[model samples]
Target: MTTVERTQVFLLPDLGEGLSEAEIVEWRVAVGDIVTVDQTVVEVETAKAVVDVPCPYAGRVVALHGAAGEIRPVGQPLITIAPLDGDGGAGDEPAGHATYREEERAGSGNVLIGYGTGHGGSGRRRRRPRLAVAGEPPAAVGTGAVAQTDPTGPADAAPAGTGVTASPGSSPALVISPIVRRLAKERGVDLASVRGTGLGGVIRRADVEAALADAAAPAARLAAVPDAPEAHVGLAPAGDGDVVIPLTGIRKAIADKLSRSRREIPEVTIWVDVDATALLETRAAINAATPDAPVSILALLARICLSGLRKYPQLNAHVDTEGQRIVQSAGVHLGIAAQTDRGLLVPVLRDAQRLTTRELAAELAATTAAARAGTLPPARLTGGTFTLNNYGVFGVDGSTPIINHPEAALLGVGRIVDKPWVVDGQLAVRKVTQLSLTFDHRVCDGGVAGGFLRHVADCVEQPALLVANV
Candidate 1:
């Protein structure tokens, strides 16, 4: 018998609560395809972004564990690979061999976002920070009730502490994962009766059924409760009003992310009113020089930001728990926060320092087109070192932007509204724009953040600062 090496291909783990199970969008390689470590093999779409899952082990794909369109839970098997035998088929599974390796570190396990161990057949969701829900009683500290559901079932519903609101004198809706909610909604289960065993009495589907079984009563047989109004009320039907669509998709994501950021991250926001008149002229000149090039202020700002990042690399960092470790990176992958119909997608421009202004504009144009057309690849959404959000395009003066997670700061560029400014003690109407810088106070204090913003402001104010290419 020809002995062949066998490896178990585990399911891709959730990047975070932002994703639960990703749809297997595409499979780059098939059974019998020889793949090396770090080679892109599959594409998966999570709630936040599409990602390419690289091959963990260098071997021949012997079998596919999951099919395309299958939403495999995190820590489940997605594909299987083995050494080709003389006849066929990968040899028997090696004793105590669990093949999984993370991208951050290659080892005996699969890669996952943030931090954790390799996949070792221990299928359990990693514990995350317990966010306080809005208007809800704190977790079972004094409730004097045993939770009927698992707390960690689905933890992404409430943004940090913006907990769900309950009707006056009514019990708060049990917090549950999206999957559980879907199942309960489908089965018409009474979510209120289901006590959660998960952290803080968050409900799970199993908890609902278990609660039902424990009560020895059918969900349908339970006492009826009055129906609540829809979450989002449409435009007032009684009043003469234009169509008012409820917020959804990109708008919703932005709202949730920003709300969570404001409520959670201690933000130190500073503002600088810059005379971007010269910068505007420079951009017009550049764009006029190359008509085909996309030369919006955002593209220019991106390049300017990249240049300034070299001077203050600490601004392009992420603060892990305890506000201790700030992961300051060398490369500048600027995430252009693009609002798409699907949601707010931050497709990254990897290694922005290498690209020229014109090239950056072209790339942004292409990437933005792709995002608008829904053709952006998975790679485009990953590896963002820092982020830039241009509210200017939408014609806003300025507003503090929430920093994208894992990044230390975010720059919000507002509309270049013509405003009167004191130039050398003289009031003058100039093409003015405001730069709102929101920084993670844990990693960087106000002084350092102020310097970064001032530097950028200087670049925008005195276009010479940018022309000098510093």
Candidate 2:
């Protein structure tokens, strides 16, 4: 019997929630390394969060598809593996060369939520062939290098007068990813005029962004000059000690999301200064009673926010811009805004309304720690119906924070400090804190917003109100 070896191509799986692409952060497995089923092969950073992608096959890694810092579209080839047989030789039938029929039998039975290798089939869409290999340098333009053809082929190639050059038998400009194309179209950037620095002269998201910046350079320079005409002015060259950082990854995601929120939502901010002395006392009493499961002020505030939402369910919802309707949530998936080294990440606590104060504290502590460590899965970072921002840790008194996109509201808590308060007509020192609610005006009028803020203030001023409401 003769043995045949065929390499299996593992295409990138569809990361859930309609995410189309991810940037390769790091590769855990190298070519020629043995990998077991469900072993993490690479770490990828999506627009929303960082995720570790696992390989479903057990084999020897033959090739890695993309290099670190490269953007790979979902359904593109990610890795290749060759199955190992007895005596460390290749298998009788290489799984990679197997037909669709053989693929049914060779399925690894592992799934990554939206994608998997099962009896049904590998849910991979065939993409355009890319000539670039991992660790290979990108092709330089105008250097007589033949441009690679994308899926569109020569029919959609850049024209001869568009400043893009092409050698015989190659397209003028290559755009392998649909994401890159959409970005260029949205930004009104002419693809032919923009130089591609990606593998095989392919244009990338960064290329589109750079083209936009270049287009705006003249206007930026004009604004810097005093009473300058609308003429092209050169920007001063960078001096020594000037460092330029490209906005990418999490920082880019944050910028896009916040920009969208600012653009789309009609927001309003209302604040109140409340005496938090009672809230502090209540926490002390709870801790004294249950030291093992002590509660935090944030947890107490979270519980209060849930209570407030119960009364004003409109605040616990998001707007459907296309549908032009306000969609309220049936349950509270509270998002705790935690500032991590990576950036600001909000980890959702599902069914938070049902959790006790102690449980909320423990879960919040664990999730916040995981977020800071950058070990949180992508699923935990999304689907937030409402966000709670505790900027008090930053020593700020109050902030009118932007509402988290899609979500209708955000409750911001400030640091609690001592202040003079009149109790029974006598001035006395009391713990004071400022509470601000930044909400989408589309969800509710000022009356409802004010009522919700007042309810929270009442709870903070007199913790007994929470007991009475309960």
Candidate 3:
């Protein structure tokens, strides 16, 4: 008979995003799997994004408290581990020392920074651990580093708690969305004066618009100048006085998505010009009929593209890497490249082709609202058959949008501008918009992608052609 000692580990406070709960996306280590401290053990999805949680103590994984996709609360036992002893077999420890001494604990002390790694287990506790709380994964930290200590406390160990540290200041700096930051940078508006109405009092796109609107308020009551101070940090370079902007949260997400797309997918782009007179007129008519409906150019473009997707099934396809096959979708789930304050977010409209023009407009409005609010569910932002980016809204002529990886293609719609064209052998003014379609050339050849774009432009140019097909 063999005797062994087991210990339970509790979930820490700031898993990330200051969230109290998190959904377990995956368990990297299962029961009985040997795991070292600081190794990634599980992946969790919070409200904002997916993150990986690391092991707190170095030991053998004895148990997992929850299954994948299960919501767990913070300060609960996530996993139990069997600590290694002198008699512990000659198992494996990487080419490094594995020491277990009382060190500083997580979520203790002066202030809480964003979710990074925390301190360690206190005084060799052999108590039961709790489940993980609902929250984002702790922010990524450097390898094998412990949270710094609090000299004021006794040289023991920090006790188990939520592990989420709170901000020290009364009015901690306002949190601004990616879209708000972009608009502010472009328009030279101060974000400090803008009152945030978002979750956790975060600054939002609407807040920036409100601040811009109040720019003419009485000088005495005016809000303090925004972002200018940060911008003017240097007139002339001083002893390496560089500004350190932290990249975490939404900015981190944007970097990951773009990097993944470029690294994993082979992309090719094709461009064409489409007559937009009918599309514009059609939108105007729809708006007049339902004054309350927020019918915009996006709705018309989405409908046209959805129709084209049904006609060209190959364009509405996804690469199945494991299956080693191309999966042509039977239905169209269109992702609109929505530019928000916190960067680019693509909210999908499921079975888009099945919906009417008004429904498309309504879904677009709802999805965009959810995205900008940072309340969009992870599922709504995932699994798209195709994507559409309206560079036209920004008054841009044309652009080659990167293909959303896994999906075969993305369509970029340019701004509609008046141009002279031959009509009845005579030059006439016509509304024209350029369309740039970038696809994964590996999945679809240039001939097929080109034909698809040409067909889509034809539908937009003569929307009546769609009526004929229907």
* lDDT tens per residue, model 3, 1-470: 23233453535336543457666655555444455545556656554555566665565555566655356777666665555544553234333324541211121231111222543444232322222211212222212122122334332221222112212332322432333444544444544445568775666678766765674521111122354433322111222233333354455656767788888788988898877888888777878888997687888788878877777788899888888898999889899888875578887888998898888988998898878865565566778889999888999999877777678899998888999977779998999999999888767788888888888888887778877755
Q: Identify the leading candidate in terms of TM-score.
A: 2
* lDDT ranking, best first: 2, 1, 3
Which candidate model has the greater lDDT, 1 or 2?
2
Residues 280-385 of candidate 1 have per-residue lDDT tens digits of: 8988887788787657777789878987788888898876667567788888988998877567788888888898877888888888878766556555676787
Candidate with top lDDT is 2
What's the CA RMSD of model 3 in angstroms?
14.3
lDDT of 2 by residue, 219-336 (tens): 1222222464333222222322222344677778888889999999999999999999989999999999989998999999999999999999999999998998889999999999
User: Of the pair 2 and 3, which is ahead by lDDT?
Assistant: 2
How much is 358 displaced in model 1, in angstroms?
1.1
Model 3, stretches more than 4 Å misplaced?
1-240
Model 2's C-alpha root-mean-square deviation from the true structure amounts to: 11.9
Off by over 4 Å in 1: 1-20, 23-45, 50-225, 230-264, 423-427
